[model samples]
Target chain A: MTTAPLGQLPGQTRRGERILIGLAVGLTLLFIAAPLVFIFVRAFAQGWQVYAANILHPATLHAIWLTTITAIIVVPLNVGFGIAAAWAVAKHRFPGRGILVTLIEIPFSISPIIAGICYLLLYGRQGLLGPWLQANDIQVVFALPGIVLVTMFVTAPFVAREVLPLMQAQGSEQEQAAVTLGANGWQIFTRVTLPNIKWALLYGAVLCTARAVGEFGGVSVVSGNIRGQTNTLPLHVELLFNDLNAVGAFAAASTLTLIAVVALVIKAILEGRRQS
Target chain B: MTAAATHTGAPIRAKRVLPGFTLSLGTTLLYMTFIVLIPVITLILKGAEIGPERFWRIISSPRAVAAFQITLTAALIATAFNAIYGLLMAWVLVRYEFRGKRILDALMDVPFALPTAVAGLSLTALFSANGWFGPVLDAMGIQVVYTIWGIALAMAFTSVPFVVRTVQPVLEDMDPALEQAALTLGARPWAIFTRVVFPAILPAWLAGCTTAFARSLGEFGAIVFIAGNLPFRTEIAALLAYIRLEEFDYNGAAAIALVLLAFALVLLVVSNVLQAWASRHREASR
Candidate 1:
């Protein structure tokens, strides 16, 4: 009764096997799903007023602005880098091509905290160029420029990594044809290659934006976390939590959670499109 | 004569077919050098400035060594769990057709998209004394928040997706006919899995686990919330580096940071090598 192979021996999983699969699924959902649900639940635990108040706080709004500005600046720059790197590495073969491709991926493996530390060393008051920067009245560390730079460093590889394989797979056939047809460089790229890799490019941009907005470790190191002045939304969440404002912290966290959800939705759609 | 003329002065050369090579490659190289490469060089230079003896002492300091120990141990524990859990998740995903399966598959990327800070906050909230799991765990005398377990938990949450994502495609592409043949040969499910399926997926799975381990080692935002950041106890290397920077001990911070960077760089090299070997093995077998 317990083990029913029935008519489908190869395809049909046994009951015990089914139970094991079910438990795996359940545990995964619990471990992964529960934390996501808990954030929003805690945010609204004290009803709408508390949630609204925390979210609308002046410092929170500033953090939101800083986070948005950082993403706005970093994502497009990384997108440009991604496209350029992908094109150079994928379309044309040259000496050190493999090294170039590998170098492009270096950021993916590097830790963001170390990235933040690197910038601090390069631009901080005590850094290699710190004295020069100080003498020149330019602030890189503990300021907006430092935050943007580190964010750029952390997110440098997203677009290139996403786009390279697609470009490589597509090859240079269309490009060669377009050249035969008398298309100029920009025209061929705009007309032929751009259309092909647009989806992957968008996928990379979305991912870049997600990381840019959510970046905490690197930004935290350089941003000085000076409340409204330097805190991005993630840093703001940390600040609020550290301030013992649990509700405020969760509310801020909910906003990021919302962004992450939207990004995931777009990602899922793009992935479906990529497959089909 | 025609070949010489074509080679000498053809207006449309094959090499020139895709123009902007120099321009694009130049920009890419420049950007990478400025953003990624230069910063790392500067860190190394800074580390170099600290005499070797002092640098050695800084990294080998009791606090520094403990942080590395905690980080490596926690990362290993988390990766071990992900190895089992992630493989099970991928297997369920690829082999089974069930209700909410697509949703489950889509949900696999939630960790990748979710902010680590947000993840840490929620996990900490759930496991803290007054949080959801807190009450249950309190009764059982188990503490997650502000402990090494919490550090491992956060790392596990953030890095689990690496294994699942890596293993899923490999499992999906596997020829089901192999499994069928194994079954027909009087092989039990366990034997078939261990002998047939495991071998094929081992390389990819190992790569995934290595990536997860490397990622967990560098994780900062998530672990800080749950880890309690106590020195020599729950403090991770990354956090300790940040603390050193905070205290204006640049050499100490740089030395610690270099050690972490070295670990990440080595793991990445190992991972690339493993992938190459895996592909070569696959090709030879084919």
Candidate 2:
């Protein structure tokens, strides 16, 4: 069936179908590709010096530092969470397994804006734990910790979502086999399960990193847009744009755009290798 | 099997074979509770604190209603466009062989990878009156930036990938025999698609569109840049919620946030139902 010539044979394109595909691809090129190109074009519109100056601007550099720090903190934690969650759900038969999976997915369905607001309401100076937090002299909302917290919230499901299905499909047979041979659980997992899932784990990690760095709504609400303090790359782009510094905004945006392109390139290569 | 017994003649203790279940599950649940559940629970509690009357008053206010209307309408428009464009893109991807097809497939994920803020900025630049496409559009008197159309465009850009990716796999997996059978019966290409191929992929397509719509509803970063955010004219519900929070009106923010949350939850339920239906149909078809 896979080799059959009956299903959508190449070179049999009908005129109407050709037109349809053309129209669709054309729309994508216009809407999707055009904007992407426009970012780079506009970023360099004033020449490389201006672009470099905008990029090396103190606030932009600070935003980059913050974004990188947030991703550095958030990705590994989520990777750990993903491994644990995937192991529990995929390797064990438990009551409420479905509920556990659904619970993990809660953040996915919730709006990032709401996720931000939820954190603010819980930790803001006027929030439920506001007085307690203030007395302790700890800041969450409008600070670095709040930015990390919300980024974690928004990017929570990526690693697990990517790795879970693969683990479930692979099953626990190998682990059981290793156990029968007197292999310790950790030994079996490290020697066997981890190797099998390493690719998926990396894929998930890449996705998590991209999302953590690019996240805006959740981080925006919590970061308070404090220049050179809590502002992330995304927030900096907005601040520049709001200040009507179009060149600076797009230049900062280009850095983010660069990260995204690199991510896409890596993801594409991984996907290609996976297919092979 | 014999390895389980021969090494230990002193009787094998039935230590659980798959260890770490308790520890892994414990950590997973604990982390989820602290990070995700607690904050969400706080939002719900806050929303409930405002009595039903006040909740209704906030949600029913003209500004809130307009936000909802604008969000829903834009999402609907985006979904409608994606339904056609996405299906075609999927068809092109699955059926035809072309140079750079692999690159094209990868390109679909750019919106997912690109920061929404970046997408918003670039799109606004491209469509604003002074931008490249902006001047052409201006000639046509079609203002996209700071308009509802811009909001819809942003939504469409960000969400179309859902439709394409979802439908692509299903379409690729479909058996050739189904289409062949239809063709053998003298069905035209369109007829075969409508009668055989379409039905096979319809459930998944619908599921994809629902998810796309759901995603569009929650979109904030991309839309906020393009949307003029005039309260009764262009502001989206997500932005409204954020605005309410900025003003320190916790009740107002919670109220609007709750509405968006409820909408998302409802869409999720609907999409899950469609997904289940799709799976059941696939099973029956097989």
Candidate 3:
């Protein structure tokens, strides 16, 4: 099932297959690489001094900082929530388990922009919780808290999707054995379940972090694009672009492209290892 | 260890790391209700606030109707393109080994990682009248950017991975013996694929296509930058929704959103059914 089938063909057929495969692969690479290459070429063509100046600009620096802060807060919180949800869904078999599984995947179907609207409907001034929150002077929209909340909502499913399948496949045998041998619930989970799921959890975390960092639509709606304050890296790129600072826009975009490339590399490596 | 066994009155004490299934299930339901269901319900509720006549007016207005038509047409074209290309890419990756195979495989995920906004901008730059390929197309009098083709291009870029990712796994898990036996009986590669391989993977391919369509339908960040936001020409439904939001017409925004939500829900159900049917087929074949 895993072996390459083209190797079994006749020499001419094999050569033809190779050429076809080469063409397909070549086009795919060109399509994927063109934008990243264009950004780099455009960014550096003007010289390093211009690029450095843009990088050091306060607004640009703040955008990067705000994005990092959001990631720091959102990633761990989602990881915790994801683990809890996955633990419940994977190990349990009560009524509504199917519905819970379906519910966990709702974020996938819902647009990030809609996710922003959802938050607005819940926490906006005219929202269900708006009065209470406003009375307490808690600003959720056009604020950092709002930005993080929507981001969290958008990325909530990643870790759970990763952890759920692995947990279900592994089942409760090991955990049961540990419990029967005198380990308590917490100890069994810590000593057995956690260790087993560590790699998958890390993989999921990497994906979630990448998404949280790159997230723009949901965050944009709530962040208000307040320069140097609520702006994320993606928004910063847009801001620079809109400001007609083409050089700065490409520079920031290149930085994000680099992060995305790194994340892709990590994901590919992890997936490859799992396959082998 | 038998502490529960010694207790005659109590049902077998359930020893578990997490709470009982009922409690956990309840928690999951409550959380999803508060977070997902409520917001979605509110979106529809807001739309309903506009009386039926007004709701119909909002959705059927010239600009809004054009946006819907353009969005649907571009999504259909892009998804069709992806259905063919993605299948080829998946087949090549799963069935062949060549130099740079690993690199090619990794590149499939570029759209997913790259922010949609950046993708839209870069594609516009690449295909616009002044872009690298734009001048070449201009010689032949072809326009892309700020046109329907540009919208399709943006949609295609973001949607390519959906079909590829969905089909690749099914292709990988497919037993090679079936193909080998067919070939041994003197069947040609095309016949074997069309007769045997295609049928097996058809359900998954259809599912992937539906997902790609749904994704393209909702895509905004990328399309907005490239679509030129021209009413009745390039404006998409999602952009219309945003326009309504920007205009502070919450009723209109909610109405458009409801249309998108309904479309998405239908696609979701269809894909789920296709996936379920495909898995059942695999089991029966086994």
Candidate 4:
């Protein structure tokens, strides 16, 4: 049964439906766009020179540098793991597959703050691995490694979530065909499976990258928020805001917002293409 | 395969199988166990260490109890609001054609793109006493920033996309002819919606709301900035968990975390059941 029951209105009431649709569209746009507009207004209202200065500050530069480095490390790690997990879960019918799928999604449900605490419990000074790590002078918490780990934890499911369903829907026919044609596993994966999943992988990576750059709660607990050292862009934005430098905060935030907007535009374009 | 035979020069290597399924599944299980399960299990174990009486006392303290109530209430309010707004937004985007529609669609993802802290700060600035909306509301003797209302607003901003994204696909997939058939049969718009379109999309809508509610319950960064963080009045459970951690109260933190976890589990179970039932109903109707 085709379910396109269009709204029916008498000729006298047709105008009312248009008004209702207009109001719904208008309200949603206003709610979604207001904050973004507010940021730009605040940023520019204080003169362009102040905005430029704030954006070009050494600390701001450092925060962006740190965030970029973290993303570089995070995106690749997640992509590799996402591929592996997606490959296993989508193709293999192993015992505990259901449980594993649920476990993979636990990070999505658990708060990022709690994820930070988990890392602390596992590798903090008093944690289970703390003694061993301490003996080797390995600092996981309040360090780059800790930041990367938490980011990985939070973004683990992205690529897997993207690729799994695609793989499931497409099935193992291509791989089987390749196998019969004398292609080895690695060759099939690199040449066959990889090509099919490349777009989904890219989409997932874009999302993971955006999330990693904006990650705060988990990183906040582990980074110790040490300004000019461990503080990421998001943390830096908060730091500047707390220090009462609202202009600087807005400037830095606007830049991050710009990056995010660009990423989102790309995601939307890709998704639109995928839909078409 | 010939490629495998050629790649492995050694005859013995060609004859050997790599145990792909076994190796990959083993690695995946080991990774999940080490990364996700162990940490959650540790939290449960730590909570158990505090003993039942102590755990109950910690979680039942006036501050903790108040925080839970406020968090739940605000989350429910936020989720309910988003359910209506998100559904409308999704419906418009999927069904309508208008000027600036593309930009409007892109704006829906702004919440996802922007940092929670930044979103929180913007809202605080916009709604504080001397700020934009703050002055307007102040004239009416109504406060938003640092109140439960602020918390709910922050949550609604972040969660608007969840329901929209979830329901949009289902709505797009729905066949238009069904609605046309209902219209031809003299069903009113409202009747058609409730009887036909609603049932098809209700499952996705509920799933989206569940996700949005869970997200709002756990939300801290955005709410923290605008919530004023008043202990008994505006403090949320997740924020309380943070406070306990700050105070070096590990047991208390674990207790609060356990409570949040329990609620999340319950919601997940309910959502799963609803999804299953809805799918079965759809199949039977078909």
Candidate 5:
């Protein structure tokens, strides 16, 4: 038998339900759906040849490559940290646990532009570490290293935040059981804990990858916007837009939009896996 | 029920068995210190080098004050819209059944997944004078691009999922029996929502709103394109800091960033406290 919704009683008219649903659908269409549709529309506004050329452009290719490399390096490091942080916080009780979580979450609240500025202060030629770096003749800001570092900083908390909750809820019972049965730490983690938490770990990595690939403000600050060099896909979009190349900008954006959609689809599947 | 286990004269702690506590916690702390902590310290140090007087002067300048005002105003406007829109969206998602609900749910996270620059670009294009919504809005005397409203729109778009995600699970887990009881008591739907439902989700909703506001304050990418970046007008505090850095005015950049950083830290603490209080309240009620 079908049960009535909580706020919907027999006394409520059908018209009221229709209106509420209509408003939500309409606004969602305007705010969320429309932008998504327009991305593709604008991307192809100049037709097939232009869209193909924009995507195949050398600068665009370099941007996609740079974005890929950044995500490749950033996601694994953050995922490793995520697992370690979750293991520490969830499996064991310790003093200052609360503080650690807050530290991890600092990036979520701070502006990305501020994150880039902070990196600059440490690594810029005249920064605190500037003299040391100059003596070493090592460039951090306005380079690939700077881009990676800031992306790492901005995305540091993703995996740990996602995995920590699931780990906490699962507790250490299975791990304890494994230890009682003579499993070593590595063995227990690999054979028991990994199988259980793998979905969450992957979920976090998906999000981290998406964020790393799309990072803009922070990366922009440090990358120096060197065309065909330190530029990423997101930065390329900005560069294209500012150059009055709206079609090319939208073309680049449509690629990122496609990536986002893929990420969401994967995220949805993982959410289902995680629930079951 | 079985009797509770009695404690011995001296409480005995369980022997630690899990490996990697030291290894794991050490890596976490060391990585965090290097990646997150040290950079932040440098920013603070950079700001401190300006000395109190100069820091004050830099932040109190007309341009700086105006940027802060615009940032706060736009953030407030964005947060206000998200507060109502978020609640309604959450309510609809949780309480109503409709086609494309799954798609709608997935789309809620686009703002999170989509790159900010793309969001900014697409939004600007969509709302610019010659674009689709631009003409409609322009004809209606409602300009979005390069205006405060545009900034707020971008802010709201990018932060759409904050409240929805936070409040969704809470709404899903809420005890519907109370609402059913209220309905049987002959209460209006609005009354039931206000009295019976809203209270249950109030802490989560507030926490969500606060986080959304903090995010709006820090937002840079989605805003810059649409905001027009007009000095003392569309320019936000973050953009001002970026401009300072571009001019090699490290001191000025640090001073402004320090203000934004402080806002973030305070809001972080507030959001954390509200979340803790929410869980505690839920536990207490249970």
Candidate 6:
């Protein structure tokens, strides 16, 4: 299966297969790989000293820190909800199962900017909870809370989607077996379910982390892009780019690009394991 | 045995007294409500508060209409390109073996993993008058950056994986027997594909296109950089909503956002239906 199954198809001659492979590879390199390479090229276009300085700049550090903090918080919350949702949907039959699954996927289809707008409609100064929040002197939108909440919203489905399929495919047979063996619910989940899903859980976590760190549109609308404060890496890249610091922007971007690459590598390796 | 809990799905729910069902479902509903459902509810309410007439007026404003037109046009173009490119990638990846195929397969997800803002920045820089591909195209009188083409390119870039990923599994799982029968019947390769293989993968391809189109409609971060955000030109609906928010025109923003939300919801349902149809199609055919 790993090798070419050429000549299996009526139209797929050796030449045709080569042509398609060349086209896929060439177009991918041009359209996909080139931009990734360009990020580093522009980042170090001025050489290591400038790239190093840009990477070490106060703005860059703050952005990285903020993005890291956001991911650190969002990833775990997503994982918790992910596990819970997967348990609910994949392991048991329920009345509103279809609706819950649909609701879980809503954020994926909605624009992140619209998600921010949704929050603004609920929690902004002139929003649904505006007067109450004002009375309490609490700031949600245009702040760190807003950034974290929106990131959570945008990435909420990643972990659940990943783990649910695995759980559904594996089914609850093991858990049912544990129960027949007189294992309690907690014991069953911990001893049987968790062990089976650990890889998918990690896969989901990796995707969630990647998304939480890179979230921008919603964060931008809600963050107010305060330098040395609320700007995450993605926002900061925009800020630096707008400031005419293309080099610095790409320098900041290179970090995220590296994270993305690492995440993909991990995902690919995990996928290989699953297939094997 | 709780009769009510088991009433709807009587057979299965009766047997599995799973430990975490209530607690897990409760957590999922509560979290979804606070984080997603409630905010969305408020947005719909806000949109409703404007009344249909006002909402219509707001969205039909000349600039708003233009943004919708541009976004739709660009998203359509992006979806079309991805449809072809995705099918090609899936077909090649599944049918052919080549050096670096795995690497290329892995690379398909770069757009997914890469931050949209970075993609936008890199694309903008690369297509600007001085960046890598700019001059070569410029000499041919082709300009990409700050145009609808740029917007479509960015959208296509961000959504590249959707189609390939969706269609790949379907293609891989396709039964060889059907094609073999077609070949034994003296069908040409094109006929085999069109009559046999293509029917098998149609639902999945359509499902992928629906999602890619939905994604293109909502795309923001990646497009803003390359599109130049010119009013009545490249400004997408999402960006327009953001602009209204920035201007403190909450009513206007809410009105426009409601439209985009509607599009998303409809597309989500359509995609789900297509996914179901695809699986059923596979089961029946297999």
DockQ of each: 0.60, 0.64, 0.46, 0.45, 0.63, 0.65
State the lDDT of candidate 2 residue by residue for A48-106, as single tens digits: 99999999989889899989989999999999999999999998877899988888888
Off by over 4 Å in 4: A1-13, B1-19, B278-286
lDDT minimum window of 10 residues, candidate 6 chain A? A1-10
lDDT per residue for candidate 5 within B1-286, as digits (tens), equals 0012112222422224577889999999999999999999999988878899999999999999999999999999999999999988898899878898898888789999999998999899999987889999989999899889999999999986999988898888887788888777777778988998899889999999999999999999999899999998799999999999999999999999999999999999899989988787677545
Q: Which tens-of-lDDT digit does each residue in B29-107 have in candidate 2?
A: 9999999999999999998899899999999999999999999999999999999988888988898766667767777
lDDT of 6 by residue, B1-286 (tens): 3334335474665345667788998999999999999999999999889999999999999999999999999999999999999999999889877778889888899999999999999999999999989999999999899999999999999997999999999998888878877777777777888999899999999999999999999999999899999999788889999999989999999999999999999999899999999999889877
TM-score, B chain, candidate 6?
Answer: 0.94
Candidate No. with top DockQ? 6
Global fold similarity of model 5 (TM-score): 0.96
Candidate 1 residue lDDT tens string, B23-49: 889989999999998899999999889
Query: Against the hidden true structure, what lDDT does model 5 obtain?
Result: 0.90
TM-score of predicted chain B versus true chain B for each candidate: 0.94, 0.93, 0.91, 0.88, 0.94, 0.94
Candidate scoring better on lDDT of 1 and 4: 1
Ranking by DockQ: 6, 2, 5, 1, 3, 4
Predictions in order: chain A TM-score: 0.95, 0.95, 0.92, 0.92, 0.96, 0.95
Query: In model 2, how large is the Cα lDDT of residue A219?
Result: 90
Candidate 5 lDDT over residue span A1-276, tens digit each: 235665566635567777887888888989998999999999999999999999999999999999999999999999999999999998887889988888988999989999999999999987999999999989999998999999999999999999999889998878877776777889989998899889889989999998999999999899999999999999999999999999999999999999899999999999897677
TM-score of chain B of 2: 0.93
Name the weakest run of 10 consecutive residues (lDDT summed) in model 3 chain B.
Answer: B10-19
- Candidate 2 regions exceeding 4 Å error are A1-4, A8-13, B1-16
Candidates' TM-scores?
A: 0.96, 0.95, 0.93, 0.92, 0.96, 0.96
Error of 1 at B160 (Å): 0.8
The residue-by-residue lDDT of candidate 3 on A1-276, one tens digit each, is 233363264343577677769777767855677866777777776899988888888988888888889999989977876777777877755556777777788777777777777677678887778999999999988888998888887888888899889999998778656755777666867898899888789889988988888887777776778887788888888788778787898888777778888888888888777777
